[model samples]
Target: MLKRQKRSITTTLLTTLFICSLSITAHARRSGGPTPSITATPVVIEHIERNLSSLGSLKANQSINIAPQIGGRIVSLMIDDGHFVTQGETLLTLDSREQAAKVNEAKITVKDAERQLSYMVKLFEKRAVSQDELAAQEAQVERAKANLSSHMANLDYYTVTAPFDGVLGFNDLSTGAMITAGSNITTLDDLSTMKLYFELPENTFSEITTGTIIQATTDAYPDHPFTGTIDAINPRIDPVNLTFSARASLDNTNNQLRPGMLMRLNVVRPTIATLVVPARSVLFDGNDQYVYILDEEGLPQQRYIETGIILENKITITHGLAEGDYIVDKGVVKVTAGRPVKILSTEIAENHLDTVEPAGDARS
Candidate 1:
């Protein structure tokens, strides 16, 4: 009887220990700490835009070199360097003494011819001169008048005048300095507007058109961006470079922009409806791109996606994602496929869904 009791007690102790071990294991699994905390955002469906960046040059709206049409010794410099001039204002003058003398001689010849023609007319009326003789005398008077007008027109060439209203540059010429025809006396520019010249690839010809808006920036004023419109475009692509030229014009009311300055330009095409998510949600594995999305069971699920253009803090999802899908926005590093995730906050996801109105069921 004593041996039987000892065996029974031993078996009871072993059974109790086994039950306690199973209980501990169950409790540990139940407590498994807290799920991995993560922040998530909902995929938004809205209009997304793509911009084309290019380098270009700034030019004056209108620029020309001020020079005399005819060569002569500059007798007068009416305007100083950097002077603002109006259209038709005289800027310089050549010596006109010789031209004046020729004009005066032609005037004397005209007077002489007129006197003779008057005498011949009276004589013809009195029958002392023939009709042919009187007509010959009349022709002389017309010939003299033509000569005088010719000299007067030539005399006007001695003056140099502004062709348009603009600011003038410095000229090396002064009084008594001789200059040849077509020599640059100075430069004049209309700074009311500026032109930006840039080129785009031939494939973009169909997308670009007149009146397209563009934004331009320069190193001189990095903080300020200048807005412009497409004023013109080349009709044909350049075979050598396989590009087409485009010109844009912008207001320069402050005169801050100048010609020949390097400019960075951005042209945005029309916007299209696409699905987008925060850039931080995307993860790269080898050559494949993916993101972590919440499945029906509130677990992290790996989804491979194809992406399109990336702009600002958002990326366009071309494939493998739907509108209203929740993605891990932050703490994606701690997320693993098929693992339960504790959502720290869904406020961002809700806000995105509420703000972005669904345009359509479009992938890109």
Candidate 2:
């Protein structure tokens, strides 16, 4: 009988433990723990105008290779590298001793021919000379005059002068160096104005035009910002790159900008109303870019966004989204689509002034 009583006691204890386990499981299911806390704010969205961007180079407005027109020994080099010169300034002189002598001899011959022609014409009037003799004298005068002009031109070719007002580069050919015609002596570049050349996509053909403003900067001069405009646009697009060339003209009168300097161009394209968003909120996945949209219950919905030009931390949303849509910036990792969210006090919304206000009650 005592053994029967022990078995009954053990059975009662086991049954009570099973009932307690069931009660705890039911209580835990009812509580479900603390949900993820997320914060959101309602902000008025404005569509921003998009700007185009490209890389370019600073160049002299005009540059020409200075070459001698006649082959001769360089007698003197009047200017060195980095020399500023004016138009018609003598840059160098070639050995023109032979040319000068020939010019003088031609002049003497021309004078003698003119005197002989005068005498022949007087004789022809008196019938003392035949028509054939008069013709010969006239021919001699014409030939001498032509020879004199030719020699004069040859003498002028011995001196090389600046074709325009500009700065000269180093004279690669030294004095007393024998140079042939068309050999490069130096480079003359007009730096009073600078021109930047860059190529853009064919889609910008209609949007860009003359007088469009541009902002430029260079590594050489970091402190200054160069302002310019669209001076010219190429009439045809390149078949290989499918891009058209664009030029920006800037005043370099102070000689601050130099040629061959790499530059960055901020070209503003035709503005179109676009939804703007903070760049940090956008996320990229493989080939597509996306952002998280907060639903009415503070849940997350994944959205793919097409991005346009990027300005600092802001980016223009070209497509795939609309204005006045709530975006979940923080707590995106913990939240999933269609899940209920409980907003906590630790999260903050961005880009909204009122949302960022310190949470302090005036009455307190």
Candidate 2 per-residue lDDT over residues 247-305, each given as its tens digit: 99998977888889888878865555667776766788899998777654445678888
Q: How accurate is candidate 2 locally (lDDT)?
A: 0.80
Task: List the candidate 2 regions with Cα displacement exceeding 4 Å.
Answer: 1-34, 41-44, 47-49, 127-136, 172-177, 270-272, 279-315, 319-321, 344-364
Question: After aligning candidate 2 to the native by TM-score, how far in Å is the CA of 203 from where it should be?
Answer: 2.8
Please, what are the lDDT tens digits per residue for candidate 1 over residues 214-282? 999999999999999999998989999999999999899988898899999999788899999988889
Q: For this target, which candidate reaches the highest lDDT against the unseen true structure? A: 1
Q: Judge candidate 1 at residue 196 and give its lDDT.
A: 93
Whole-model Cα lDDT of every candidate shown, in order: 0.85, 0.80
**Candidate 2 C-alpha RMSD relative to the actual structure:** 10.9
Q: RMSD of model 1, in Å?
A: 14.4
